[model samples]
Target: MRCRASARVDVSEACNLLCVDETQSEHRFEEALLRSLHQGVGRKPRFFAVGAAEESFDERWLLQVLTVAQQGDMASVEFLVRSRVNKTMQRSIRFLIRGAVGRFGGRFTL
Candidate 1:
């Protein structure tokens, strides 16, 4: 079964923050954030990636690559590569190229 990012509210208001230093590392902030959220709560609430649930990263990427190919837009194609899609998408990319080839009957080179 496919898993999704769990739903959660921003816990920033539920407690008092003692530290707000600009020098804090991102990983440190993440650790602190998770700890604070789980602590002092009445129950153990499910936690998710801080931004994963809010971001439509995967769907946006799929649309981007496919749109680029569909329009034969070279810039969007390059943008999709720079978007940091994972290797698993390579199979989908190959499938898309094959489809384009089949659809256009070799008249267009992807």
Candidate 2:
């Protein structure tokens, strides 16, 4: 009986269905986040700047990584953490250099 039931299931089709479900769930979450942000203080200049930066940011990818982490995907979490750390370090270095040049009355070059 189990063999008969298993034979009726197409593995590829099942995988496709699961993928669709996951994609829909992610889409819903993204919409909800956007709605909440809009309803909140997303229109103010400060918040708008943050939102603009974040729109260019990979929030979706971060969300996926976080979800995977919650599911115990340690490797994905580690990679994401390392990537974030590197980005933060680079931004900090740039900010410090810019500040130093500004303090010395020198033009900061990228």
Candidate 3:
């Protein structure tokens, strides 16, 4: 089942971020974001590097990565990498790269 952005109002409120109005494009964007994090559908060189290093995929790592990716704040990302999540440099770098890719799309050549 699909979740509405309205349904996540508390989440936005907690994060002090403005809630985007529900629209087809917004829904599509959210879905794409989900797919990229959950299924690795999008091209992310950093994520690829992390995947290469790990024997098994980590959902928690992916979620944290998604959070950083969505926020697009380098200082916050750096803080998250250092303090919050238990990840290697490879994984942290990948998360940073993935966040950048999410914010600014281009040929993620690496």
- The count of residue-pair clashes in candidate 3 stands at 0
Q: Which clashing pairs does model 2 show?
A: none
Q: Give the runs in model 3 whose Cα sits over 4 Å from its true position.
A: 1-57, 84-96, 103-110
Tens digits of per-residue lDDT for model 1 on 1-110? 01223333334431223233434333333333334333223234353354565534444554455556556675666556444523434333333332332323332322
Worst 10 residues of 3 by lDDT: 9-18
State the RMSD for candidate 1.
18.6
Q: Across residues 5-85, which tens digit of lDDT does each residue of candidate 3 receive? A: 223222112222323333223333333333333223223212333346553244355455556556665565566545533
TM-score of 2: 0.27
- Candidate 3 global TM-score: 0.28
Relative to the true structure, how large is the alpha-carbon lDDT of every model?
0.39, 0.34, 0.38
Candidates' RMSD to native = 18.6, 21.1, 14.5
Q: Candidate 3 local accuracy as lDDT?
A: 0.38
What lDDT, from 0 to 1, does candidate 1 have?
A: 0.39
Off by over 4 Å in 2: 1-55, 87-110
- Residue 46, candidate 1: alpha-carbon lDDT: 52
